[model samples]
Target: MSFDIRPAVPPDAAAACEVLRRSITECCVQDHQNDPDILAAWLGNKHPAMVASWFESPTNYSLVAVRGDDIVGVSLLTGAGKLALCYLLPEAQRQGAGSALLRRLERQAIELGMKTLYLHSTATAEGFFAAHGYRRDGNVRSPYGVETILFWKPLAEGAEPESKRKRFCNCNSA
Candidate 1:
């Protein structure tokens, strides 16, 4: 029932991937419709080795939510403040783990001087992100045909997000 979130080391990649895969396969049934082939295709590029490599890469910052020695949820934030990955196992859902993981990622983004945080949320997770104040910008179809919501939340309170701001260019002939 208790869990802690922490920066992920390379060795945690396998467990993190397991958490992610279980979330996708079990918790996101509506997105994949219980199609094994679709799930396989969705996970083909997300091998544990690739997850480990991402942990070693400078472009990504990964985090894991652990209960005891087991990872219950996982997330990876990119250098650009994009939440490139996030998921919680079925057992971890609705227990404050996902929200805590997101809050941790947002804190890290703010520490990195990011103005906003963005993520593509699966249909199953859209409400979760929305509840945390992420605004829906649009929708996108994944390469494998899963529909996702493009969402972003401003890190600094009351600041106008650049993506939602109006721009005017003045042009005059002198």
Candidate 2:
């Protein structure tokens, strides 16, 4: 099925929340590993109310990938150039929905005059981000205790030279 990427609306909160929850629960087994505690911590704030707040936040730019009536993926970017959230349903994985959402957000960031785009990527998504021109800067332990890779990409030519970009070590330690 063909998918379309569009700006997320407040009414889309519940569907987006479901996509995020399912994508993490099913598609990210390598990260969560069925650890009950880890899963609970990670999904603790993924409620529809919280998701709606994100969609309505002026500092956030959110989008949803849809196939007809179903939301297949959800993405959000902060005004400060952080690709805060990117999740796709298991059925939508490897089907171009993620890429579409990424490209659209990148464009949005550039239009907003952002020179770089950065995110904390799960192990499952590291290679995907690398393939899309994001460089691995370091690793960090997430609040939920997962080791996530930090990735960043320059949004435009002459934005920031790699040599000048700050590189950090693993932040898993105190």
Residue 109 in candidate 2, Cα distance off native in Å: 0.2
lDDT of 2: 0.85
TM-score of each: 0.88, 0.91
**Deviation of model 2 at 76, angstroms:** 0.2
Model 1 quality (TM-score): 0.88
lDDT by residue for model 2 (54-159), tens: 8998988999999989999999998767788889999889999999999999999988989888888889888899999998877877888788888889888766
Clashes of each: 0, 0
lDDT, candidates in the order shown: 0.78, 0.85
Please give the RMSD of candidate 2 to the true structure.
4.0
* Candidate 1 lDDT tens digits, 125-157: 888899999998777776666777888898886
User: Candidate 1 lDDT (Cα, whole model)?
Assistant: 0.78
Which candidate number maximizes TM-score?
A: 2
Q: Which regions of candidate 2 fall more than 4 Å away from where they truly are? A: 161-174
The most accurate candidate by lDDT is: 2
